[model samples]
Target chain A: MSTRGQTHLWVVQRVTAMILAVAVLVHLVTIIGAVRGGLSAAEILGRTRGNGAWFAFYAVFALSAGLHGAIGLRNMAAETIGLRGRGADIAWLAIGLVTAGFGIRAAYGLFA
Target chain B: MAEPASLKVSVWRGGEQGDFARYEVPARANQTVLDVVTHIQRELDPSLAYRFACRVGMCGSCAMTVNGRARWTCRTHVRKVVGADGELELRPLANLPVIRDLAADLAPFFDKWQRAQGRFQPKDAPDGAVPEDFVVVPPASKARREADAGIECIGCAVCYASCDVVAWNPDYLGPAALNRAWTLVNDVRDGAHGDRLDAVAGDAGCHSCHSTQSCTERCPKNLDPSSAIAGLKRRLFWDTLLGRR
Candidate 1:
């Protein structure tokens, strides 16, 4: 990867970190409130199903978490085990794609 | 309170594959760690190898590991580091190749400095003639202040020795070099601003800094390389966003 690519990753990491900061807080609070209010998994899905706004929100939340986590793990892998360069980049990309894939699938499942 | 008659010192004996050699030296009032090593080299064992110049702390030539911490031996008094049992352990600085008893090979450290583009390149006129007019920069200007904040580095490499990132990644440019680049990056008259920023943007450059503040903690000059590195990160972040690089 070029230096620009690394810089892009650095920026992406920072921006996604901010997204995760808010997303995680909202996610935790909402989940806690919902579960404590006696909403089961079926009731939660029933409330979220066919809702475009909820689908978009959850999808963005999941995507941001996936990217944020992958970048952080990429850094840890590089620092702790010396996994870096093109191979490391491709590996992390695969991990991020897989995570986003599953996350979007789950979000769609909840919505539909 | 009475002082001990003699102190037991354990000095590294050889290069990469060496062990500590024990020696007893007379304890004195207000003695530095360098003084104890000198006593061993001069009176006890002439073969003991170490490096020191300008017995005062100005030159930064006498840095060594005293009791598991990188420090300027010339500036570290015995009373400050001596164990409760009146013992001192001396070795070469960490994160660099050990050359001998108390000297580390600084070649890699200096090479990374060059790789980080730590040197200044003065801006030149289009006609390639030296400008006769003096470039006046206000002392209190933000740029000059940023440059001044990191300009007191004595090239001690104490931060390099103390950095965990350097230990984890040898290719990562250590704090001193990155801090030097930060100073040059903030120089208004510097011609290589973009080039220097690019030089220090990637994995082995300023991005690798973990922001542990170990450099700031261990610096003998009280300089904050950690903040300088943060400055570089902000510069690169903006440059990347603005497509300036």
Candidate 2:
């Protein structure tokens, strides 16, 4: 890979990390607020469902988590175990799919 | 006169497949790790092999694992390394091919240096004019200051041996080479900036370094390869985004 590509990835990874920092914090705070408001799952779903705004927020969270996690796993393989090959690439894709699948599905379950 | 005593030293005795052979060398007031190895080779075992050039620290040849850390044995004092048992354990430099006892093949270390473009490529003159005799860069310039931080690395494998990334990733260009590349990249006279950046940008290059600071913590010359690697990463980040490369 070109240095430019690698550098771009570095930027993407860090930027996603920052997004995740904010996203996770917002997610936590939202959950705490919901609990403090004594909102049931039915009530939470009633509030979140058909809401484009909540859907958009969760989508960003899922996207950031996927990008951050996939990049991190790629880095871990390269740096920790020295795994760099077609196998590693395929593995990264698989991990990204699995992680994003769960995150996006839950977001859809609540917001869609 | 004082009581005559000996230092309990454990010297590694063979190639990669070997164990530490114990020796009771005559302990002196100002003994160094190199002195112990030299004494063991000369007096006890004629077959013991280790490399040393300058008895002083100028030559980086005598680097070995004293106790557990990579050190230039020529400059490392015995008093500094001896445990409570007054024992010293000597082994070949870690993460290298040990040709024999205490003598590690540094070819990989040097090979990575070339891979990192650790050399000076002169810049051409502007407007098709002849190249000047010299390029005047200020001593206090940011580039010069950054370059100066790592320019003093003596090609010693101490940093290479200390790097955990190298231990995990054989293809990763180790710290000494990357540090050299960093100095060259910051050099105002150097022209192969893009090529140098590209060389160290891939999976097995600068980005692979986990910033463990092992190289910085153990550098015999006190150079911060961790910082140099960071500079390389930051430069690559901007050059990549700005299309400067």
Candidate 3:
């Protein structure tokens, strides 16, 4: 990869990592609290469905996770299997697209 | 007085496909790993091929893989590295072509250093200014401090030998080279900042480091190549943002 491309990918990976740190904490806390509070699925869905703020939060979470996982997957293949060049680039991009597709769909289903 | 038992030393005796040649050498109190190698070469087998200069730790030529770790053999005392089994193992540095029994060819390592532009380029001395006119950098300055961090490298391939990145990717510049480049990047008197940053920012450069800190762990000089690589990353981004590169 070119210098600029590598630098941008590095920055994106770090940024997504920071985002995931907070997202993961919020997600774990919410789920644990809901279970402890005896909130049923219907009751939980009532608050999440049609909620703009919740949709936006989950959207950001999904996108950040998708981007972060793809970059990490790309690095794993490169370091472990010596994968590089255009093929590896395309593979990571495809992984990112599919991951974001599913994640966003799930997030939107629950809230949008 | 009771005589101490001899150390069972196993030295690698050939190229990549070589077998371990065992020998029983009389141990001494201050016997170093290099001293054992020297004894094996001088007394046991005159045909043993190894490289060393300035038997002290100043010269980096005496480095070898001792007991599964890269180290400067001269500074490594047998007492410190001797296993409970009263044995020692020695081999050529890993991740390099073995030119002989204990000396891995350093050409590839040096080539990577050159690839990373690990050299000082004077901006103020185009015509080679006199020593009195040299750029006198203060010791407390950031540039000087950063440069000092990486300046003690003796070109020992211990860090290179210990790095898994180099083992995984042959094209990677390894830690020592990138660390040297990071020093050059921080040098205020050095004019080739953009070129140095460009040389060390891509797949084969600082970005390739996984920050596993294997280099920092195995470095005999106690230098941190991982931190240097991080510095390079930060500096490279700043340079790009400032339109310096």
Candidate 4:
């Protein structure tokens, strides 16, 4: 890949990190408060189900996590494992797509 | 008078694959590491190979791995680097291939500087016409100040030897080269901003810097290559966004 493409990935990684920061904080605080307030798994699902706002928020969270984690892993693989070049790029993209796929599916389950 | 103290110094011998040859040298007050090496080569073993010049830390030509850290041997005192057991270990700088005992092949280091476009390209005078007016740049200008911040680098590979990124990625342009490129990038009168920016962008470029500040921490000149690399990153990011790069 060109350096420009790599730069774009670098920028995207930072952007996703920012999104994950906010998302993780909100997620932990809200979920911890709910559990401490005596909400069960089914009760949490009841609150999230049919909620469009919850679906969008969780979907965005999933996407950011996927991109952020994959990019970090890609760098680690390159630096540590010496996995580089086109093969590594394709592998990382697959990892990101799979991770985001599962996360968005779970978010859809909650919404539906 | 009490007997003079002697230090057990282990110096690396041979090229590529070699072992540390130990020597007992008389310790003197305010003795530099280079002095110890010199003593070994002169009195102990005439065959020991090493590289040095200036001997005053200005040239950075006498850099070597002293007691596990890359340093200017001419400036590093024996007292500062001796282990608790009063032993010293010297070797060639890390990352670069060793040419002999303490002399590392600096071709790759300098080649990366070229790869990073660490040279000034003057704006061409059209058709054999020389401009009469002088290009007077203010010393206090922002670009000049930024350039000044990184201009003191003496092409020493201390930052390169200390960088984990360079150790991990061979193709990665090490800190010294990238820092040199940063100085050139900020040269307002230089005509190669676009080319230099492109040279320093990408995975093996400034983006590969993990911001560990190892370069900043190990720099003997107190110059901040990490900050310079961050400047390059910022410049590249903005350029990409503005469609300039």
Candidate 5:
């Protein structure tokens, strides 16, 4: 990859890390609150379904995670196992796409 | 005469996958870890192998894991590293392939130095006469001072061994290499700032570092390679944005 592209990846990783930190905290707190209140999965689904704000938050979180994790894995593979070149890049791109697809699909399920 | 105080030292033996062999060596007052290893080799076993030069702290040789932490054995006093029981565990540096006992294969470690373009590439010919001959570098400048703080790295691989990024990613250029690149980048006479940034800006370069500061902590010289890597990151970001790299 070009030097600029690498810098962009590093920046994206930092940004995603920040997003994940907040998302994980919020998710954990919500889970704790629901469990303490004896909320059922059905009840949670009823409130979350068609909730635009929740859907948007989760979508952003998932996309960030997908991008961050894919890039990280690509770097790990290249450095640790000596895997590089176009093949590694393509594999990472595919992984990112799949993760983002699943994330978006789940978000849509909640929203639709 | 009272029997000499013998400390049971366990030194790693063999290749990448090996077991620690126990050796009984006489412990002396103010003896360094390197001294202990030397004694074991000289007195007990000629087969035990390790690497050391200068027997001081200059060559960056003599690095080994003492009590679960990477250290320059020549300078690391056993009292400081050993636990209350006076036991010492010596092994090869982490995150690198062990060539033999305490000697690791430094090919990958040094190769990354080349990848980072750590050498100074001067723009002008050595014999060429310049319009303004002297390049004045003021020691008082912040950049020069920042460069000076980490100028003493001995290529010991201590920082590299301590770095978690290197453990996670073997292709990572490592702390010492990136630190060298940072110094070269700040050099006023060096004309390859753009190329150096290009070399170190990538996935296996300074970008791989997670800012864990393990390099800073385990550095025997007390140099902050973490700061150097951070400087490279910032410089690379600016260079990339400005189309300089």
Candidate 6:
């Protein structure tokens, strides 16, 4: 990858990390609130279903996690396993795409 | 006075890949690690190759992986770094391609310096008027002190050799380049602040740093290049937001 593209990835990783941080906290709090109130999975789904804000929040969370985790793993693989260059780049892109697809599918299942 | 005890040294021999050749030399009081290497080359094996210039540590040519750590051989006392049994394992620095026995290729290491725009770029020549006196900088300023702390790098690749980032990403500018950029960023007289910052802003630049702090730990000058790079990142973020870049 070009130096500029590499740098952009670095910046994107950090920005995604920030997004994940907040999303994770909110997700954890929501879970605790639901469990403490003794709400069933059906009741939780009732509140979340057809909610645009919930869909958007979960979508962003999943996308950020996929991007951040895949990039981080890509770097780790390069350093630890000597996986680098175009092959590694393509592999990481595949990993990110698969992760985002599965994550968004799960999030969609929660709403639909 | 009685003669000092001998030090059994195992120095790496050959190029790129090599094995260590053992040599026994008499150790003197107040002897440095460089002294041991020099004695082995001169007395035992003339074929053994190594690099060094100033014996007092001014020139950074004497840096080597002594006892598994990158250090200035001239300044490193054998007693301090050697094993408890008084044996020394000397080899060339890591990450860079080795040229010969105890001499790694420095071309890639130095090229990053230029890539980072480490050199000072003047804005304009002093026309007829003597350039309005020296630019006064207060020592107590936080930015000035932070800059001064990492400014004393003598082009030694000690920090560069010790860095993990350089090992992982070959294109990464390494610590010396980033550190040099940090010094220039703090320099009030340097005209290429914006350009320099832009040069060091991206991935191969300051953002590649994982902050392992190996550079700070290995620095004989005790300069913290990692912190300086972080400062550059913070400054660049602000600059980019304010349209300063």
Q: Give the Å shift of residue B240 in candidate 1.
A: 1.3
**Candidate 3's residue-wise lDDT over B16-109, tens digit each?**
8899999999988888989999999899899999999988878899899999999999999888988876689999999999998999999999
Kindly report which residue pairs in candidate 1 clash with one another. Answer: none
Cα lDDT tens digits, model 1, A1-112, are 8877877888888888888888789889878878885878888987789999888988988888788889889989988988888988998988987898899899999999
DockQ of 6: 0.43
> What class would a CAPRI assessor give candidate 1's docking?
medium
Candidate 2: Cα lDDT at A11: 76
User: What ranges in model 3 sit over 4 Å off?
Assistant: B1-3, B124-136, B237-245
Q: What is the lDDT of residue B159 in candidate 6?
A: 94
lDDT of 4 at B241: 70
Q: Residue-wise lDDT of candidate 2 within B134-206, one digit each (tens)?
A: 7899999999999999988887799999888888888889889888989999999888888898899867788
Among all windows of 10 consecutive residues in model 1 chain B, the one with the lowest summed lDDT is B125-134
Clashes in predicted model 3: 0
Question: Where's the lowest-lDDT run of ten residues in candidate 5 chain B?
Answer: B123-132
Tens digit of per-residue lDDT, candidate 1, span B1-245: 35577899999989999999999999999999999999999999999989999988888889998999999999998988898788899989999999888889999999988988898777775354676666888999999999999998888789999999999889889999999999998888878888888888877888878899999999999999999999999999988888877
Task: DockQ for every model, please.
Answer: 0.76, 0.63, 0.59, 0.76, 0.38, 0.43
Q: Model 4, range B91-113, lDDT digits (tens) per residue?
A: 99999999999899999999999
lDDT minimum window of 10 residues, candidate 6 chain B: B123-132
Task: Score residue B1 of candidate 2 by CA lDDT.
Answer: 31
Which scores higher on lDDT, 2 or 3?
3
| Most TM-score-accurate candidate | 1
- i-RMSD values for every candidate model: 1.0, 2.1, 1.9, 0.9, 3.1, 2.9
Off by over 4 Å in 2: A1-7, A78-82, B1-4, B125-130
Could you give candidate 2's per-residue lDDT for residues A1-112 as a string of tens digits?
4555666767778778888888899889988888885778798988789998888888888877887789788888776666777677777868886887888888899876
